[model samples]
Target: MQQPAVPELAHTQTRPIHWVLTATAVAAVVALSTVARPGSATAAQSATGTRTTTAAVAPGTTGVQFPLDCGPVKALVVKKAGADLDGDGRPETVAVVHCDAPMGTPPDGVYVLTRSADGRRPRVVATLVRPEDRLTVTDFAVRARTVSATLLGYSSDAVPSCCPDLRTPAAWQWNGSAFIRSTGSAHSV
Candidate 1:
């Protein structure tokens, strides 16, 4: 074979010192990466100059005594969604509850649950749907501090209890003092 045009470079030739230097550089990079790290960030700062990163836990529906009076049957939470509804940092839970009956469809009652002043237990703050309304809740959700749901009900007294003929889309939002309800046109199911 013909001789190469350029001579071999020093780096191309591997020596014992080259291996030791390459290992040292890799070790230094790892050591520096582990030693230097960014600090944790705080979500909000208070007037007292204290930083808080902990978020308030959303209220749970369990053990909450709703305003509904279920004499023999216990109230069961069929659906629930949690969010910061009233612009408060703490989150509130909107629960769809109904009496656990052995047979037949039970009317659902929608209640907004929040933690008590002591943050010990959840309490019903608002009632969006009453069991007396004879409406069943469907597609229930809480998004962007607004509660939206499709309510199913009977068009008239003659309508069978098992079948709801009317379907209405409803939404509720906190207007400072109370929850304001807005509903869409009712249509036959």
Candidate 2:
């Protein structure tokens, strides 16, 4: 047996619903902009604009007041030694200081901060304290992997004894990695 022929439906054109929704959204945005604040939008628009200004202070100096609890940092100095102390290619940094409390009382003892690289944050590698003798460091020098720190001893003016006016100077040397007391007669100035 053979099959019969089937009929087709009529074709019709239709506009997309998405296009109408998009036009409605654009119209709403325009209406909102017309009723918005006058300068608010303009200020936001100019936020990325370029402007010229000058800095009041130079680098490495504090411009604003800072807290006192940042710790006592009296003196700091760094120099490049000819030979490397840590076996690295870079020279060592010699930072000497007179700390406030942790090292000693009133006039604190001396500290040396050693570092392998220059312009880097120093770490406290060695500290010299003479609390019993009441000594405080005043100056220091580091050369040939040895550090000689100068200390000043204080004495009361009320005592009128034959003590030779105690102004003794002590020295400490760096034995490759650590500072050790040098054996010699304690020099008095």
Among all candidates shown, the one with the greatest lDDT = 1
lDDT, residue 132, model 2: 40
Q: Which residue runs does candidate 1 get wrong by more than 4 Å?
A: 1-51
- What shift in Å separates residue 25 of candidate 2 from its native position after superposition? 66
Per-residue CA lDDT of candidate 1, range 1-189, in tens?
Answer: 988999877688789998999999999999999999976432477899986866667888878899888899999999998899999777899999999999999999999999898778999999999999999999999999999999999989999999999999999999999999999999999
Looking at model 1, residue 2 earns an lDDT score of: 89
Candidate 1: C-alpha lDDT: 0.92
Q: Candidate 2: which stretches are off by over 4 Å?
A: 1-88, 99-108, 116-120, 130-133, 154-165, 187-189
Report the CA-based lDDT of candidate 2 relative to the real structure: 0.44
